[model samples]
Target chain A: MTTEPRLVEVRKNVLKQNDIIARALRDRFREAGVLAVSFVSSPGSGKTAFLEKTLTLLHSRYRVAALVGDLATENDAARLGRSQVPVKQILTGTVCHLDAAMVQNALDGWDLTQLDFLFIENVGNLVCPSSYDLGEDLRFVLLSVTEGEDKPLKYPTIFNSADVAVITKSDLAAAVEFDEAAVLRNIQAVRPGMEVLKISAKTGEGLAEYLEYLERRCSSSRAGAAASN
Target chain B: MHELSIAMSIVEMAQEESERCGQAQVLAVHLRLGQLSGVVKEALLSSYEMACEATPLEGSQLLIEEVPVEVFCPKCDGPRALGSIQWFCCPECGTPTPEVLHGKELEVVALEIEE
Candidate 1:
């Protein structure tokens, strides 16, 4: 009888390295007292616009920086840089999602202690970004009114993975006949009692609450770190 | 898609594993893909073939075992395998179960190396 192939047991999680790096980054963020947040959504969901407004608004109060990821271009970084915050772009180059290594590398010359908040704008895709955690304290998933209301139900994994849900393009909700209640219900069904916020970046509506939320998280995180020390 | 990158990583792992075993030829790679892993098996299979070319894992098969979604049902006080993909509720008591017990795995369990 012919010899059989040798069976070797190699139990390894493919994303273990990414997870480890992300953990380290999270610890670093904690120690440095910087609140890091990330945004994930499908393309055309207005993440860039929302971030630009946030940067412009928050820069007056706190030291903020941004790292944006994309497959090819630096266009998003360019747009956000108009807010006058330190912005950098990580070109993924054929990669659909941003890993922790990329985030770490992008932060290379910057001192985390110098900033109160660091924003990572992930490449606009709901599916892949959910799997890769870039060491963010807050992960926001955006859904636009123009998109269907069932997006949360259809993509439950991303919604479940996210800390909060953002309804973008709220100014056009009535114009597009978007079903606000149904979308809220769908989000709640996928992730029960998940916080949902409606905002129009163009009109600056609901941004005060968003900024307040960020301020609360940053202050609380800093306070927690101080207490631990 | 990201499957291509994932497949490339799998091929890299297989090649490294082969080298560790004194450059043994890899016959196949066994993977545990969960339903909640967010990876499409068919796309990964095709990407694996493309990724294996010119590598030590060339011509090796990527055998995938799909893991269905399972949840720890608080009401049932046990784990229940989802009957369908649509809803993620307890099958026994019909309660929403958000605590996932399984189906998020993406691991390389074993490999079939040439003897």
Candidate 2:
């Protein structure tokens, strides 16, 4: 008897299942007239703080809910829930990022058509989150002034993947000696024609602009979907 | 790390493939990894071993083929391989091009198995 090991051709994407689920989620979100948005950043980039403020600000005007992901704790979901919005925490345990399956599972029992906007705050990591699209209409990538100006250039993939780049903790820019020009230049260098925003959730500075942007995003996304349909 | 999850996914995929091939023993899983795939090769390889333990892929090998980034350059009127990581620009004309032609692959291409 002869022993032989044969090579079998099985060409398939490892993430094909995730992609299919994500596409279904996106279609459902669009049909329900809900804007699904996500936020990603490095740890301590003020994503939770910014989301807390956003939830509070938009809660009165729109039916808002959030899914917060963390490696270990539900602290972020607890904090965001204080705004009195439906908040759920997806504890990924050791996973560095949230996938579409997690997002879909978390939305169980909730009618998406009832909400105007649904936010998913991803696990605080710039690299991994970029690779996983959670069926979001828009993704905001956050960077704090304290992180240094070259952050976007250092992690260009995240910057390139995000629909918008947010500069958080603007109120502390002066104290931290943050160079706005350098940061802007770096962002432009890495992802040209990228939309950037500056905001401070603590002081409400630029919050108005941020909200307006969100409103515009919701409307435009819905309008685009309606037109395409 | 997410690499562990991805490694598990690979193992699961291998098991399915083996089952489809009449319960053949998978000797190795071949993968095509791209630079833009966002997975660190070393981390994934280490995670693969751990994920395979106590599973059908326990002694199997993961063979990875790294794909280089390629961009569609309008200035060059064609796609070009990015030689360096400094920028996504056309090497000949130095014009920035965001149109990616390749290097996002994270596919399981083949399997070495024995009946």
Q: Which candidate is the best by lDDT?
A: 2
Query: How much lDDT does each candidate structure score?
Result: 0.90, 0.90
lDDT of 1 by residue, A1-229 (tens): 5567989999998888888999999999999999999999999999999999999999998999999999999999888889999999999998888999999999999999999999999998988887787889999999999999999888987887789899999999999999999998788777665788899999988898998889999999999999997
Best by DockQ: 2
- TM-score for each model: 0.94, 0.94
DockQ category of candidate 2: medium
Q: What does DockQ give for each predicted structure?
A: 0.63, 0.65
**What would the per-residue lDDT of candidate 2 be over residues B1-115, giving only the tens digit for each residue?**
5788889989999999999999998999999998878788999999999999999889999999999989888888999998654477888888887777788888999999989
lDDT of 1 by residue, B14-85 (tens): 788888888988999999998878788999999999999998788899999999989888888999997654
- All candidates: CA RMSD (Å): 1.8, 1.7
Return the lDDT, model 2, position B108: 98
The residue-by-residue lDDT of candidate 2 on A1-229, one tens digit each, is 6469999998999888888999999999999999999999999999999999999999999999999999999999888879999999999988889999999999999999999999999999988987787999999999999999989878887787788899999999999999999998888766666789999999999999999999999999889888988
Which residue pairs collide in model 1, if any?
A: none
